[model samples]
Target: MTAPASSSTTPINKQVGFINAFIAATLMGFVGFFARHIDAQGDFIAFSRMMCGGILFFAIIAYKGRLLELKEFKLSPTMVLSGFFMGNCLSAYITATQHTSIANAVFFIYIGPIISTLLAVIFLKESMKLATWFALLAVFIGMMMISGLMSIDSSGLSFGMQFSEKTFFGDMMALYSGVGYGLFLFFGRFRTEVPGDVRAFWNFVFALAGITLLFVFTKPTISQMTSTDWMWWVGIGIVCGFGALGTCTIATRHLKAAEFACVSYWECVVASLFVGLMIYGEPLSSAQMIGGAMIIVGGMSEVLISILGKSFKRPDNVTLKAGSI
Candidate 1:
């Protein structure tokens, strides 16, 4: 049998792992900050991030002598499709951030888990526990609350359906981003041969190429951005794109998925803080706070059930898994 991970260096390793995970999550939370500062269109921002991050990802692989690993395992067609979905997600998110409050954008983007679960049930013939169904309902209710369609305002069950046009469009974009990300997750399940880092590298490569093709029809707003904006774009690409992805990938090797998830959820809370207190100064309304809580609880409930249900889990069943990439 292999030795337990509780060796002499285990404590130090665990400490480093926790720090890396925290840093990664914190950097992800700063995505809205960078997006707000960068004066460019969403697609252009997405393209820049993908191109720069892909370069860095490939450079790291080459430096580490893993570039030749491509000969042993090429990216699958499914991975290319997954990358396309990821590009959609990134593009939508940047646009949503520009139009909506960061809290709303981040909260709704988490709907990916619910969408991915439903897609798995429909497409992959997966089964979910009763708890998973309830969680889905909770998330739906939370979404309605966040959208201002349904809320428990101070007047008690107020039908204060007041959604500005920009926010409404932004909320829809955020929801679309979640669906795109859900599809990305769904397609990613089929890439069993490619290592995670290699898959990430190619995913960004595909995203860069796909987004570049779109620019041929429409002018990229990058042409209008100032030098300062370019700096911020680079920062987002290196810090939020590559830095967060690379560190989070490493953290998984040291921590259980459940432990890493607990860390990952903090990204939303941290983002809310930045959005409300630092960046936008727009606090989450009472209804939105309750809704956000429900969303988090619902998503985490499904994940917890999966972790606890040892025998009930299956590798091919997406409902029984919780992942972020």
Candidate 2:
């Protein structure tokens, strides 16, 4: 039997989605750590991630007695398109990193949120609240700070950065990755009839296919990987791939695209923290601290406002029934 659409989400469900999104973001933050330890190329690692994650996802469904769901799964245009976009998002991002500076790649990749927000507003007709606008601006500024594109100096704030033609292809790839990411988020919401698990599984399937094609073209040295490398690849698959994207897929069911995009900024913040504290052992710069705080505040602004607003209006004697939610 097909899973029903989870369109009528309650407040409690939204809160749960928020929590899952947060956890997913946190897990995604450690991806860099795993990538650093793996001796494989970016595309190969991405391939391994999709391969292992897809297998694990299938296993989970079987364990849950939902394997029959796959038998009825038919390819929809939305599913195929979304899967393609997600695949490109992952592979293009890694390829971009190999060609350009990490800062440039990250800055461009995170632009996906802004694109997603715009697409949601235009296509999904989701209303943009005032707080959401402010949050978006704050998060954008925070990203600029964290990415080193906007810096504060004794002379004053400087905002200009130059790019070289040598990295032009990489920059374009990064921008394409952002577009792919945005499109994936949009299409994820577009086809809510599909269960989250099924969507996620197809995502891995298409992603693996795309990455494998890339491998065929680039011919990465996958044969050189050792047992330790394989272990790291598996870790990346289980943690960043399955753990993060699985929850993220679920989150899209309860949250509007824009809201989810804002919440997803937590990944950048957590990743920055991981790099500064765990990987590099470097202290966070003033800009980073400010940026991180802004991201947290901006991301939580709507939820916090909603909670506080409810508290003021809710009666002390009122009790919610189990069925009310």
lDDT of 1 by residue, 1-325 (tens): 1111232212213334455567777788777788778888888877766777789978877877777765655556777877777777878777787788755666566666456556655665556667767776775666556545566756776544334775998888877888876666566545433454676777787777777776776476556789999999899889887777556544543433333443454465556656545678877777767765875686567556655675324332222111112
Backbone clash pairs for candidate 2 read none
lDDT by residue (tens digit), candidate 2, 191-255: 56455677678878887777777777778897888899989999998898888877777677556
- The positional error of residue 265 in candidate 2, measured at the CA in angstroms, is 1.2
TM-score for each prediction? 0.70, 0.88
In Å, residue 41's CA in model 2 sits off its true spot by: 1.3
The 0-to-1 C-alpha lDDT of every candidate, in the order given, reads 0.63, 0.75
